[model samples]
Target: MVLLLLVSLPINIIFHKVKLPSVMGFIVAGVVIGPYGLKLVDDVESVNHLAEIGVILLLFVVGLEFSISRLIKNFIPLLAAGGAQLTFTGLAIYGILSYYGVPQNQSILLSALGAISSTAIVMKMITDRAELETLHGQTCIGILLVQDLAVVPLILMIPLLAGTAEGGSSSVGMAFLISVVAVTALVVVSRLLVPKALSWVARYGSSEHLTLLVILIILGAGLASESLGLSLAMGAFIAGIIISDSEYSHQIFLDILPLRDYFSAIFFISIGMLLNLSIFIESGTLIFTLLAALVVVKIAGAFLSAVVTKNSSRISFVVGLRLAQAGEFSLVLAKIALDEGIFEASQYQIFLIVSTLSMLIAPLLIQGSSKWSLRLFGAGDETAEGPKKSSGSLKDHVIVVGYGHGGQNLSKVLNEIQIPFQIIELDGESVRRALIENFKVLYGDSTRANILVQAGIMRAKAIVFAISDFQATEQGIKLSRKLNPDIHILVRTRFAREVEELTNAGADQVIAEEFETSIEIFSRVLREFKIPSNVIEQQIELVRMEGYGMFRGISLDAENLRKFSTYLTATLTESYQVSGECWANGKTVEALHLKALSGAQLIAVVRGNEVTADPDAAFSVVAGDVLVLFGRHASLVKARKIIEIGDGACEKS
Candidate 1:
């Protein structure tokens, strides 16, 4: 284990710098240090043990992320898509292998292997690219969830496929039934005990105790399942699902994250150790040809699955490309196959090599999927309901380019005013949300030129880039400006450093979160110090006019600071609402003698929107009247007390 880390760490560092996935790096590290390469450590038993733990942890985390409620909620739309994907992909692989003289049972096992895509790799890549909420991302997740669930049945099939089950078909069916019963019982029991136990630990135990308790639960569940003829991975996953519905699930996930990552890397490394490099060198052409065929078959199957489930052409194409690799579960099945004599040593080596290569290529495919999808599908709107043709009828309208918080608020304001506007969002769920709210929203990547054209950017009066993806925002700014030279482009970025870059990319106005937050902070501070509202507004206006330069480290001129200081210290006017129980309510201005009592002049009294300015002393004040007073800060403070509680508090003031 120590040697594995020493070899893997530097490789991972270099891989990170080159933008390669850490999973691939760990696998490569294993290949280099395993017996076939450098012969650094030939003993494999200990590594395999650690690798088993890693796989269990990996599945546990996956289950934690995939709560039962999400699975049920997404079932209606995603079920057909996910099921079709697994079925079609498996059938295609089975057919191809059978045509080549592979035995029926071996072909079936191999097909299962080819049907599942690497959830770990695909998810990590999409999350890094910030596309996990996009249509294709959601589609991939749904399909992967189906694949993960399929692993159990696939495992059960292994004994029957290898002709090793004592009761043949009946045994397999009984095993499936037993597995289901065990999962249900585990969930029911954990649901009753886990939450209360966690709550008690949180109330009375240290974090270390909580951590240890969680580990105990995970391993104890695994051991229980193993004792009942089930896989440890299955029990860990069930444990995760049960805990996911609890309030402490997120905390548990965070606490176990380091262990999960550590074990997961070991698992992938063990996978790489199983491959024989000599076989690859001897039959390189055959292996490459097989890998190419697998990629094509997987992509085509996934694409058809999406199309069959009524996804738009763009989303379908992208989903196909995104799921073109075999996953960790594939390795588990392959190992079982090897043990059952479904695979020879060399054949297992080939499978391992092909699977690793496919995983390595998945990230590149996902990163370029949007552009490839646009080219293939002609940039049609990919909405949750299906493709909708873009209209050019929208003229001089605001185009909000994301459906997140900023975009949602902007759309509401535009709708309230009855302004012509359209929204372009990539997130399928957000697009659905916008539709539910009756907003005109188009689902597609705004960074793509065709998506921009489809949104009628040529006729847009203004476009707001309200997305958090800075790269996409910059590209959209440049593309929108090119399409509509006269249109206003407003952009919001999270960092001050991005302001100059966005401006150079043709954004007419850039709002940096850093500067805006600082501006708001200072404005509130000024309000607390009794600066008049109008004066604060002027300061805010001036700050914006200077492009937030003052907050960005551009020094304010001495004269301006002096003027600001003067405003802070000058006599100011303030308005106070008269409550029914106030001392000044129902009192004549002359009788109250506000000026004499508090040394603050009553500049005006507003009654039901009628203003009595500089009135004679006979003017009467009433409840609900707004009193406008002019005075120094200290005098205004004293006058407010005199108005609130009569002359008894006036002496204290």
Candidate 2:
């Protein structure tokens, strides 16, 4: 265990710095330190036991993140695009392997393994680029979701394929029955009792206890499945799905993440330990051939599937390239095949090297996919007149990108004010919603130059990007600026850190949710303390002019700092209601010597809806009178103290 951690830490860090996935680093570390390389760790059995736990935790987390609502929401892509990609890729590999004289069952297993794409690498890259909400990102994720589900049936097929079971059909039927009963019981218990148990634990248990409970649930499910002759991973996955619908899913995932990473790393390293470098060196040609076949077949399958779902050719091709590699699950399936006697040592070595190479270059493929697609298809379907042409010729209009909350609100105000506006949306569901409301929405990615042109970018008065996808927003801003140099561009970002980058990308104005939320909070707080509305507005304007610099710890010049200090302490009005217990219950304004003591003036005094403006020295103050004082902040504080107590209170201070 110590050896695994010591070897993986620096290796993973180096990989991370080089912009490679840590999974690859772990695999490489395994190969370097395994018996095949340095012989640092030759006891594979002990490591494999720990690695198995990693696989279980890995699948458990996958289930926990994959909520049922998400499945239903993406059902179309999951069924249409995902099903097509899987069928096409799997069939192509199967045919190739079968033609080479591989046995039927072995071909099926290998093809299934080859059909899967690396969810870890692709998700991390898209998430890092903030493209998860982009059209192609969603399509890629949907395909991965389907592949994750496919693992269950593949695992179940292992024993049957290996011919290790006793009664053939009867054994299979009995096994299926047991599996069904076990899964049903697990779901029922999770739905009916696990939530209540979790609630009780959360309410009364310490955080440590909560952690232990979740760990128990994961391992207990695994044990139950193993006892019933099912895979531990399958049982844990089912448990995760049941808990995913509950509110505790995210918290549980967060709590288990450290363990998952640790174990998953070990699992990958163990797979590396199985590698035979001698075999890899001898079969270089075969390895490269298989690698080429894997990429081409997967890309073709994914591209065709995306096209069948009506995705633009550009988006389809990009999605295809993004998924053109075998993933961690493929390694898992390969290990099972090797253990089941389906793959010879030489074949496993070849498959392992091919899978590792595919993952190593997966990020580059995804990063270059857009440029590749554009080169191949030359603007593709984005140039087609989508909803933009249907909206008719528009000029001096506003172009809104992403029909999300910001876009919707902007559209509503534009309509009320009778301003001409057009919306460019990429999400199918969002586009449908906009069309339902009779919005002049173009259904395409705004990052495309042709899409911007179709939206009257050259003639539009302004363009606003209210999308959460930062990469798309940045790209759209640059494209819009390139299309129309004079058009005003506004961008909204979730974090203030992204403001400068978006500005550099040609956004005329950038509003960050973080700083705006901070400003709103401080504004409300000042209002509660009776600060004048005009003064509050001034503070807000000053902050905005400085680009929210104050909130982000940006240093201000002495001149600007002095100006802000003056604005904050500038003379302002603050009203204080006189109480019966106050010292000024029956005193005249002049007799109180208000200005002499606190340097504040009693500008107005209200008594029973009768207000006295610029009260004279003779105006009397009493209980229930609302004294409106005007002065600097410090002066107001002193004046309020004198009014509440006696002027002697000010003298003592």
Candidate 3:
């Protein structure tokens, strides 16, 4: 294992730097080291097992980001586009196989395999390009999800069609019946049980535990499906879909990502191990013919489907061209078909040749897709428009990039406070939501200068970049600072290592979620151990003060530290200040009988520079005093009205 890692390390590095897929590099390395080449690794089974883990992790993360609500909203297009693609592609392949005089069972299996595109490769490519939030990307994912779901029945039907498994026709009938039952049960269980189970797990707050549970679920589901005469991959994919709605999905993805990377590397390597170069050299003409036929059929089907779904000509062309490549699961289906005597060895060889060539050429096809699309759709006549003007003036308004969870939460708070803000989002659905909510949101890429200008970055009070991609966030910060140096730029990051880069790019505040979560967890642990609250507060303040200027040269002093501490404690203690209404607007704490009715103590009142500490019981109330009160939870509730009604009065209780 160590040797394998050592050998593959340089190849992986080179591929990454060259902007090529790492899995492609892994396969190349595998081919060089396999029996047909250098003969380095002989145990293919172990490598395959390792690679399978990567597949699970990849799919799990994909599921984590799959929003069912978004799918439902675009269900009609998804069904139309995806269904048409599958039907046409399958039929086209079937026709080709029939012309070649292939057996009926073999033709169906081959056609089904050809109909499916690579969920793994397509998703990885989209994610690498940082285009997963775009309309085209979402459409691709939705179509891929439908295809992945279809693989379940296809796998179950394989054994029956091949006559390899027991119970004959009854087995085929049972398999179909069982699949329907399983799918329905899965939906019901996902709706009723998964959420509660995930919630319970989250309450425990152990990421490692959650990750282990996810693995178990994936493997367990896969095994169960296999026992019911279905594909393990299908089960794993379904398991991913079920957990996609869970709140812990993100964390689950993060935890399993490393495993997925390792396994996917192995999976590609295993694919390389299966290839016999000698046979390819001998059957050159036949291999080339099969490959050409596969690409033509698949691309034609996808293109027709894309057009039928009402996508732009360019989008349809790109989708068709991109999906011409055969996928990983196609190999599995071919193997099953061969083992069941549905396809002869030569036919299997043809399948392998076509699939391998398709995989190898996919990147090139994708790269040329835009050019091809332009040719297909007349140049300069693309349907998609350039950036549009924002509703409001950009001056002094907050510019928010990325309308993800963190950005959404921030927007909500800003809305409540009536702060002028404009959002830049790539996702069409998110952009639509923002517009419907009467927000100043523009659909554009934040990394582009024009997009930033459209969002009013020049005169913006602050720019909050909550994009998940580190590179994009850094680029946005750099551009925003160049556009307007005086603007306050806040960035969100997943790791502390990204903090310095964002800071160097001119971010005023770099909020590292993981770092913050760590601090929060440690603080909770301290509290659990019965640490003194004041001591904990002091420690937290000290750490913040020391680290404050490390990124942006801002520091917290004693006064500010005290204020933060008070704010934290107030929230922790559930004590809040509510403004006084017309009835008690002019009354002092004593006159209002606050102590008697609410059992609350007035700690201090600040009116501009005047700080009245522990005012007398008979002190007359003023309209504009900023109240700093300390009280029981029930007392704070009773005093809510008194704290909310006064003019120029803000709560810091």
Candidate 4:
């Protein structure tokens, strides 16, 4: 493991720096370390299992992030483009294979494989390029999502098809029925049982417990599908959809990230292991032919799909070219077909060769799409009409930089409140959607001065830097301040240290999400201990005030530090409050022998508005006084009974 990491890590780092997909590095690493090369990975089966895990996790995460509502909203375009692409590509490939004299069954299997593009590779590339939220990105992702949804049925049908005699009936009636029934059962169980089960586990308030529950749900669902002779990926995808709306979704994603990365790496490495260099070297002509066929079929299908969606020729070409690659899932399909005896060994080899080459050339095709689109169309031409210019002054309008989740939410609230605003988004799809909704949105990057001006930033009352990229946020702040020195800039960030930088760049307020979340978690912990509401509020206020902007640098005085320490101690105790009826209630500290309560320490007595700190032995306890005690969790629970519900020694009043 150490050796593999040592060899692959540097390559990955270099690839990332150069802005190339890391999958390329993984492939190269695997090829170099495999038996045919340096012979580092001798255990082929272990490596293959690791790779399979990677594919599973990759699909699992995709399912988790799938937005069904968004997909349904754009259903017409997605279905139209996706269906056209798949049909045309499949038919084109099938015809070509037949012309080349390939067997009927093998040709059909190849066609199905060709009909799909790599969701894993394409998504990674789009995300790395920061284009997943862009117009082309959205269109590509939407189409790919439809394809993924289709793969589940394809996997099931492959086995049935393989079992049919040559030239016999190709009836898929039974498979379809079973599939529908399975889907219905999954939906019912997920809707009725999964949420309640998850809620019960979540009440424990343990991160570990939540993580375990999430994994169990995913794996359980996956195994259930497998036991019914269906694809595990289908089950995993369904599981993702079920949990996507849960509060723990993001946390679950974070928890499973390590597993995803590890498995994905193995998946790529396994692909590398499968490649036979000698086969390629000996059949150069065949390899090129297969590669050319795959590319042409994919591009043709994508282009036709784009046209059907009402896109212009230029837009269609760009979309087609961007999607002209066989993705990771294609390989999964090929493997399944091969295992089911749907394709001969030689045919499977050809498909793998074609798929890998397509992936290798995908980056080049995508990189040139923008420039090519402009050349095909006209420079500076908006496919849809540009936003209409305002007839009156643009002053007092809010300038929103980014139309993502946070930006969209803010815009919705602003609209409800009747606030005029101009939104600037770099993504084409987001801009397109906004335009369709008749929103005052500009398609451009806010970091650029010209784009900001186009969005009426100069006359804006406040600039909301809602973009997640920190460097981009800083740039926007600097540009906005330079253009309008008096404008208020509100920036959102994930780190506290970014506040100072943003403020220095002329931001009026910087909201750090991580810091805010941490404070919220701390507050909840305090509340669980039954701390007085006012005390908790005061501590929170102090933390927020001291933690924001320049005040973060100043050290607290001794008195304030002591106070903070005391609050922290009280917050950590699980159950430190005792009811009035407890044996220790109305008993002086000396009389109760407070030292005997393991790990317990009395901090103060809250009697109405006055607080008694480190009280003397004569400090008599009042019935209504709330005792502030600190101790280990178990000790705190025992002490809580004395101050809260009271000990069993209480008599009826």
Candidate lDDT values, in order:
0.80, 0.80, 0.71, 0.71
> How would you encode candidate 1's per-residue C-alpha lDDT over 146-172 as one tens digit per residue?
676566667888888888865566665
RMSD to the hidden true structure, all candidates:
5.8, 6.4, 9.1, 10.7
How many residue pairs clash in each candidate at the backbone level?
A: 0, 0, 13, 16
Residue-level error in angstroms, candidate 4, position 627:
38
- Per-residue lDDT for 463-577 in model 2, tens only? 9998876656777787788778999999888888898898899988889888999999999999777576677888887777677788879866687778868976763778899
Q: Name the regions of candidate 2 deviating beyond 4 angstroms.
A: 45-67, 98-106, 123-134, 156-189, 220-254, 271-275, 339-341, 366-390, 393-398, 404-421, 459-461, 494-497, 511-554, 557-563, 569-629, 634-653
Q: Write the per-residue lDDT of candidate 4 for residues 207-304, one digit (tens) a residue.
A: 88888887788778888877665556667767876777777778787888788887777766666666667777888898998788778778889988
Candidate 4 similarity to native, TM-score: 0.62
lDDT, candidate 3, 412-521, per-residue tens: 99999988888988665677788888888887657666678778877789999887655556667887887778999888876666777778879887777756776677
TM-score of 3: 0.62
